[model samples]
Target: MSQEATFKSIVCEIFGIQEGDVADTKTPEDIESWTSVTHMQLVARFEESFKFQFDVEEITEMDSIASMKNVLRKHGVDL
Candidate 1:
């Protein structure tokens, strides 16, 4: 799989969403599996999966798949 696919897979699995349903338009409001603890868990998972750290602000601000992609880009995740 490509990096984008890897990222999307990680996010989708962490949030308990199907890969087919995990689009850029997806948001926390659209996923019942999303919650504060879920976000923190996701942050940790992303850090481990990407082998880089992210600021809490960035973590807290990721309310959508698109936002997560932006954060990943900002951290030089190679899209």
Candidate 2:
């Protein structure tokens, strides 16, 4: 699957939501399941699936799907 597809799948699984709900503009404020603990879980899952470690700053910057895409792109991820 493509990186974007994989990303949406992960987010859907993590947030217990449907694929249609995972949008680039969605943030923690928009998702009830996106708590602090789940946010770390997301970071771990993303790092594991994408094979890249995110530094503290990048982790903090990932407040939304769009921001996560930016950080992943900075790490040379194609999507």
Candidate 3:
């Protein structure tokens, strides 16, 4: 799968969202499964999947799927 698809799939799984519901606009507020703990878990998952370390600024800015995607891109994650 492409990096975009992989990212979407991982987010959907972590948030307990359906594939059809995955979208750039989706935010933590949109999912019942998304909370502080789950947010950290998702960050760790993204770090592992992308093989890159995120700075505090990046982590704090990860409020939505689109932002995360941009961060991954900025890190040159072979997308």
**TM-scores for candidates 1 onward, in order:** 0.87, 0.93, 0.88
Which candidate leads the pack in lDDT?
2
Reference-based lDDT, residue 77, model 1: 84
Candidate with better lDDT, 1 vs 2: 2
Worst 10 residues of 2 by lDDT: 3-12
Pairs that clash in candidate 1:
none
User: Total backbone clashes of model 3?
Assistant: 0
* lDDT for each residue of candidate 1 in 1-79, tens digit (9 for 90 to 100): 7778788788778788888888788887888888888888888988998889998798877888898889988987877
* Candidate 1 TM-score over all chains jointly: 0.87
lDDT of each: 0.84, 0.90, 0.84
lDDT of 1: 0.84
Candidate 2 whole-model C-alpha lDDT, 0 to 1: 0.90
